[model samples]
Target: MTKDVIQTIKDRASVRAYKPKEVPEETLEKILEAAHLAPSAGNIQPWEFFVVKNQAKIEKLTEIAYGQEWMTQAPVVVVICTNPDLSAAKYGQRGEELYALQDTSAAIENMLLAAEGYDLGSCWVGAFDEQQVKEVLELPAELVPLAFVTIGYPEGDKEEVRPQKELDEVTTIIN
Candidate 1:
């Protein structure tokens, strides 16, 4: 049975280990579609995604990520880039400094939840050498590398429970 959105969000976890199996093309497409549908500031939608599947490139990316070897285990790694110029053209400094990153973050979150709904494992990877990633991907200067999300069938059981703050501890609702 297909899981509901709330359940999917609740079940999502950062998976560092993955099996040798590859994610199906259709499933990957669905995840991408979810990201595409994410809300963006001023509808600029400045995010771009590079789906990395080639083993050689993945290995190079692992190096760029400062030897985060676990990332290479996933069959796919999505590099999220932001076109700051696009947002800047629309909203000036605020757009370039913050909105672009915020928009891309929303897209990444959508992809994470979609991966969980598909019964796939994923982890958001933000630590990496941006210049190296741009060079490896041959991206234009305007496209700034922001993050990476690795996806695959998990190698073992779900991640062990991690502590989280209660909603009241993290939120303040205004009357």
Candidate 2:
């Protein structure tokens, strides 16, 4: 059955385990396309993505993430980065301090939802040593590592749904 956007969003969960099979390049491209289309402040588009598929590198990343073994389960890990200078040039201090992070986050979310739409499992991993990650990836000085989104076929059935707060409980209406 085909799922709508809302259903796709609802289906997304932080998948920690995955099958051993590799993700196809075409599928990965589609997910990246969604990220590329994400909106950014002043259209500066300060985000960059690194698709890491090498087993050795993935292992290194797992170590960089403080031995988060689940990171290695996914066949692909996309590293989302922010080019602070690019955003700063366009939106000034606010862009450097906030907009760059915001833009990269939005891009990551787009990729996550797109992965869900493709019937894939993914997890957003933010806890990592930035300096180590930069060294591992050999990132330039201008690019700041933000997060890693691991993508792969899940090991089992759909992810277990966690409870969420009701809209009324979390929302505030000023009108």
Candidate 3:
């Protein structure tokens, strides 16, 4: 069997390098739509994506990400931020930390798959200074910076998928 959606899920990898070509606006719109359709806790959909295609904004984000210069080269940098006001009030502070991050992550994953399906490339960047990102994006005090996603055309052929440990190594059957 060659593979399918399940294989796509298993084969997905974080692509860091990208070609300098601009991604078409329509493709970006589809990726955003897929992200927006992601399921959320309490259907809050508290996530907001800042699609930064401007060179200046990309430069600012690159600086905020602490010299991750590759960020600026990508055609689009999507800053996934979460708004607390949209979240359920019952969960409290812990809710802010858990639900928002999880929801945004799911959205990001959906977007990455959408990109792959469209023959685009994307990477989820979570290692960054949150405060610097917030300041660069001019985010509201209530919005939390969760992750930065870089997307573009692949710079080179990704022929080899990373090796995976067999299921027996990590799974246990009980039923």
Instruction: Give me the candidate number with maximum TM-score.
Output: 1
RMSD of each: 0.9, 1.3, 2.8
Q: For model 3, what is the alpha-carbon lDDT of residue 12?
A: 66
- Alpha-carbon runs more than 4 Å astray in model 1: none
Arrange candidates, best lDDT first. 1, 2, 3
Query: What is the clash count for each candidate, in the order shown?
Result: 0, 0, 0
lDDT of 1 at 30: 96
Q: List the residue pairs that clash in candidate 2.
A: none
lDDT of 2 by residue, 75-175 (tens): 99999999999989988999999999998899999999999999998999999999999998999999999999999998877666888889999899998
Q: If scored against the real structure, what TM-score would every candidate get?
A: 0.97, 0.96, 0.88
Candidate 2: list runs displaced more than 4 Å: none
Cα deviation of 41 in candidate 3 (Å)? 1.3
Residue 156 lDDT in model 1?
85
Give the better candidate number (1 or 2) by lDDT.
1
Residue-wise lDDT of candidate 1 within 74-144, one digit each (tens)?
89999999999999999999999999999999999999999999999999999999999999999999999
How much lDDT does each candidate structure score? 0.94, 0.92, 0.83
Question: Alpha carbon lDDT of residue 159, candidate 3?
Answer: 46
- Candidate 1 residue 45 C-alpha distance from true site, Å: 0.8
- Model 2 Cα shift for residue 45 (angstroms): 0.7
Number of the top candidate by lDDT?
1
